[model samples]
Target: MYNLKNKTMKNFMTIALLLVMVNTYAQQVDSIKTTKVETVTDTVNGEITSKKIKTITLKEQAVKTDPADKGKLNADRIFPPTKVKKTVMVDYDADPFYDEKTTLKYFELNNDNYVFRKSNDGFIMNVLNKDEEVLKANARQTKSGPYYVVNSNEFDGIGFFNKEKKFVLEFYNQKTDKLETIEFAEK
Candidate 1:
């Protein structure tokens, strides 16, 4: 029985070797055939005619929404919408406010035009302006974004953030009347 098993194993090995050899030969033949190219040209004679491609340009007149003679045209540009700018009001005239028994109220100024609120911690002088902000040693570091430095005060050219109930920022700029915020990572 061992002799019979050895004979069968040898036959199977021979068949496997034959199959591998057949597959390798098939692949090599295919590779050689793909590299071979066949080109055939047959000529048919006809009368030669000159052909020119001419481009027709259609000039489209801009459709006039408002008639040329209908409305009066102002020479001056319609400003504001066309010209964008940082229109932070220079609130230099805001009066001072102090804490009362519980609520905060403005001091006796020229008019009853000032209003104040109690700070979360202590006194927060909000009526200060751009020039007044420069007085403080802790000036916000604003290198990124559109920043314009006037004297020592830095203003974002685009705009300032708007907060609830006229409160603009961590510290409001009394000079420029814009909200001032400390928004830079310490180096």
Candidate 2:
């Protein structure tokens, strides 16, 4: 009877230890969830805008014991490989010329005082509402042909003549600080 009592106590102690280990493992796995939040804001023309983004990640906490390593946890098997992704966003006010999806050939300059004309001699600055011509500069000649360079002065850019003898003008926009290309086909 004494031997039987000792065996039963030993078995009870073993079951209790197994239960404790299982509970500890379950707790570790449950703690692997994480949450992250991000916010972005921008101010344009006296108006403020903001955006919030959230991310949730879960990692596996289970480790496999390697038989070859004397029952030690395998470092490579503990964590799974994850892939990273990247995103890009673009935001800007709508531009009329860009929204049209057509290449510009003409632009009114200085409150309609001058109309830019594209010609073989680069862009011609002409008086608006008049047939008078103001200034004409020939595009710089290259081995392939005349390739105009866009500059700040607007008139200091290149012009190309199509078969119809109309001008295509490329110049710099001072306000937007961008290069603009337009074609003026009207004779």
Candidate 3:
């Protein structure tokens, strides 16, 4: 009878230990699941969301123009080239690759406006614009004869002009503190 009791006690102890281990493992699994859920909730709260906006005020609308049409200067037809004052900067030479795309024809025309001849459905530019700023316009030979620039001096150009084909410019002699408008367009 003593032997039977000892055997029963051993079996009970083994079963008890296994039960404790199983409970501990289940508790670990629950803790891990809780941590994962909390992490997912935090991420959702931190994420930013954007919505589509569809509203415009009447004043913000733009005027519509014909799609298949070209605009021409109303000079002579309506507004005879209104004399306007503007600062013109002259650039002798600039990078053709980059300057050709960003400069405007009005600012780049040389003294002798470019002479254009029609060819291959486009005009050829025999000369180039002097104003580096104008030539930089991303303009190429359009239907209009090769772009030509008029002498700005004739348009009340900041009080400097070589009416007699004289090249005029101001030279600042820093040493003499003298700012002089040198007019020597005609030798």
Candidate 4:
């Protein structure tokens, strides 16, 4: 019984030693092969031409970087400040929201002589060159479509668009201390 146990232990150690030797040999034999093929096509004067390129790499070597020189930027050596061109920033006012393709809806209030232009979020109102005000409002979606509700320190209103390209606003005016209904038709 003791002889059988000894024989099995020897067999296991021999198999483990053989596996370790095979793994060590595989690590020592380090080589890589890569093949790349590229094709280019060109057409000139209705004539077609094609070119093929093939590249093969037998082995690759890893680049060794110094641990002491880690995180050291070579900015001054690569791009000197004197050789770099100074960027000139022109003082120009450009409106990003004003697109050439966008059609602005302009409306005039008949009773108050106030003109309003429909913007992205709200209405931009001008009272006959006397005053220009921007009223920010949000649209509330309903079954009838989207309706804008404007609530500000000056006035509070609920406005909706009609089929006649008119915006009807029912609002309470704080300055005049009156409830007013105004219609703005697109012009």
The numbered model that scores best in lDDT is 4
Local accuracy by lDDT, each model: 0.32, 0.50, 0.33, 0.53
Candidate 3 ranges beyond 4 A from true positions: 31-187
Candidate 2 Cα misplacement greater than 4 A, ranges? 1-125, 128-132, 136-140, 148-152, 163-165
User: Candidate 1's residue-wise lDDT over 94-163, tens digit each?
Assistant: 2332112223322212222222333343322223253332121122324674322222243322222233
Off by over 4 Å in 1: 31-187
Tell me which residue pairs clash in candidate 1.
128-174, 129-174, 129-175, 130-175
lDDT of 4 by residue, 63-166 (tens): 33355666776322221111111111221123323122212334566544444444566555545444554543333433454777765455568878889767
Q: List, residue by residue over 14-85, the lDDT tens digit for candidate 2.
A: 999999999877644323545555556888688986555444444443344344566555433434222221
What TM-score against the true fold does each predicted structure earn? 0.17, 0.27, 0.17, 0.32
Superposed on all Cα atoms, the candidates' RMSDs to the truth, in angstroms, are: 35.1, 24.2, 33.9, 29.2
Evaluated at residue 143, the lDDT of candidate 3 is: 43
Candidate with best TM-score: 4
